[model samples]
Target: MRVAVAEDGALFRQGLVLLLEAAGHEVVACEAGGDPLVAQLSTIPADVALLDIRMPPEPDGGLVTAERLRDAHPDMGLLFLSHYAESHYLMRILEIGTDRIGYRLKEKVGSVDVLSDTLTRIADGEIVIEPELAKRLVERPRSEKRDLVASLSERERDVLKLMAEGRSNNGIASTLFVSAKAVEKHVANIFDKLGLHADTSAHHRRVQAVLTYLRSQRGDA
Candidate 1:
């Protein structure tokens, strides 16, 4: 796949270019900030661009840049690269409203094969979310709880917290030291309380619950 990378650090930019090339993918452009990327975006035949959350002038300039680029190049897939797991950044990125996108920690780029596969998946119109964001969702403080989460009872809230963490019924049961049957009941109750019954898709309910949880934390929902 053809790729473009936008990162502020010179070493990291070159390293990413090299890594993509070594993995048998083309690196069309490796820019330091959003302006250069916008200048080159239309002309370059790149499939996806990996943007860092912090770049040029301010810390979250890239988020705005991604929004602009998404409007200009809706077909182009975008991936956000972050230094640490910040759920607020993920929530803000989602607000820009683009699909075929992803948010992952810089630490996730450890393996060449994984990076190559991730780029391929994103370019193929997939939403590749990082697991860290899931954990970050549930780890949010109680003072941050909003209407959606505030409505849930304590046990149901515990289930929702683990659910946002991507824990399975069995996994949550083990964590809570409850029976799997009890965990199943909790999961159903969670879906009911969150009003997530509309979708029959395999992961729709889970995704909705988690996004709601995170958006509540960001105070956007």
Candidate 2:
């Protein structure tokens, strides 16, 4: 596969290039920042674009570039590499409505096979989420429900899981085989029961829920 990498850190960028090239994929272009990458995009049609979530000029410049690239080439696969898997970042990528999107943590980059598999999956039009993220997505709401799960309806707990997974109301409906309106009511109930309705971004809510969940799991262990 033809790939392009956009990352501001020289060492990390070079290490990625080495990894991808050694794995037998062509590294068509590598850029230090997003602007050069945007310029390079005009000349090169990449099969998959690997981008760092944080880049120069802005913290989310890579996300901005990904959005632009998606607009210009809707079919192109895009993968975001980050040190931390922020819920807001995942939410923004999903908002783009592209099936060929992936979110991976940098620590996992040590495994060439994993990285290659992720790239191939994205290229094949599958959404590839890291296992840790997936675990967090499932566990987040269960933790929040510890004090209230007994009182809350089963549907409310389901809604909370889907929300932590960064699903929209429509997504939760489809997944749960319920109507969007029903999902909406469940989400509202969840917020009310959990007291998570005020003074927090959706990003913060999801992160907090996931962290709480993970901590609980550790305590259980």
Candidate 3:
């Protein structure tokens, strides 16, 4: 795969280039800041753009760049690297749609395999949010947020939370230590309760379920 990267820290930027290149992906372009990345986008062709969500111009510079990239080149794949997986960041990412995008904590970059997998997954059109961000979105104080999400049982909510985290059934199963069959049943129940019967694509339904779960928990806050 071809990749472009934009990170303000020189050491991290160089390390990233090494990692991607060593993993058999070409690093076609590397920039020290978001603005430079945008300026070079027309000239750089890449399958995925790995970006840091905070940088020189603003704390949210990478996100701004990602949004601009989405507008300027809708087909571009995006994977964000952040110090913290805050809900606000994820919200903006989801606004770009739950496909061909991902969010991973900066700490995860230390693991070459995970970082490579995240980029590959995003390039292949998947919503891959880090676990911490998914937890926040799914486990917000239910006492205040329950009304809208009350239809789901506690276990069902657990399953849906992992689902929203972009986990496949097996992934959710491993996280919750439940059988894949049980996870499948929970997903079916979630779909029925949340009215995700719009189409046959489980991927689409999972995205819709996740959006519903996040929106409900984030209601008017």
Candidate 4:
């Protein structure tokens, strides 16, 4: 797939370009700053654009670039790459309502195959959320005396615990000795129990929920 990567770090940007190129994907454009990225994307259209959540000039400049691109070229897939998987940052991108969006952690960039597959999936109209984000979604509280997991069955809770540990649906299935479809169903149920509507953008809420859970756990200690 043809991709354009916009990151503030020079070394990281170059590293991404090299990784993508090595994986037999085209890196049409790599920019270290948001201005150059915006200007470049104005002329060079790509199948996917991977942007950092925080870029120079403004901490949220990359998000601005993403919004602009979504407004101008709705067909192009946008992916947010970040060091910290803050739920609010992911939510802001989903509010744009563009399909084929992705949110991945920067640490996962070590695997070119996974990155390539995620880019392809995002371009092909899949949400392509990271497992970490999915875990956060499972921990949120939806109602009085009911955390997100309260509505889940025993099987669903097991799936959610695995998800929090960064297991994919297939991985969860393998561990539970069930089919992938069962894992998917459990995930869907978890989403429903959490009151995460059909907005196609729940990454931020997931992060927030996880943060809240972690803080509470620490406080209890």
- Clash number by candidate, in order: 0, 0, 0, 1
**Tens-digit lDDT track of model 2 for 1-221:** 99999999899998999999889999998998878887898889899999898896497888888888898888889998999986567667766643788888987866679788788868976666666675465545345456665566777766766664445577679888999989878876766776555457654554454445433433531
Q: How high a TM-score does candidate 3 get? A: 0.85
Question: Residue 83 in candidate 4 has what lDDT?
Answer: 90
Best by TM-score: 3
Cα lDDT tens digits, model 4, 42-98, are: 998799998988896487877888888888888999888989886566556656643
Strongest candidate by lDDT: 3
Better of 1 and 2 by TM-score: 1
- Model 1, position 186, has a per-residue lDDT of 76
Q: Could you give the candidate ranking by TM-score, starting with the highest?
A: 3, 4, 1, 2
Error of 4 at 42 (Å): 2.0
Better of 3 and 4 by lDDT: 3
lDDT of 1 by residue, 1-221 (tens): 88888899888888788888889888888889987887888788778889988996376868877887888888888888888767677777767753567778877876798687678767866566676666556555346464555677788777776666445576679888999999888777767765667565545556666676567666677
Regions of candidate 3 where Cα sits further than 4 Å from its true position: 144-158, 170-182, 194-201
Clashing pairs in 4: 87-204
CA displacement after TM-score superposition, residue 29 of candidate 2 (Å): 1.0
Clashes of 2: 0
Q: Which candidate, 1 or 3, has the higher TM-score?
A: 3
CA RMSD of all predictions: 5.3, 8.8, 2.8, 6.0
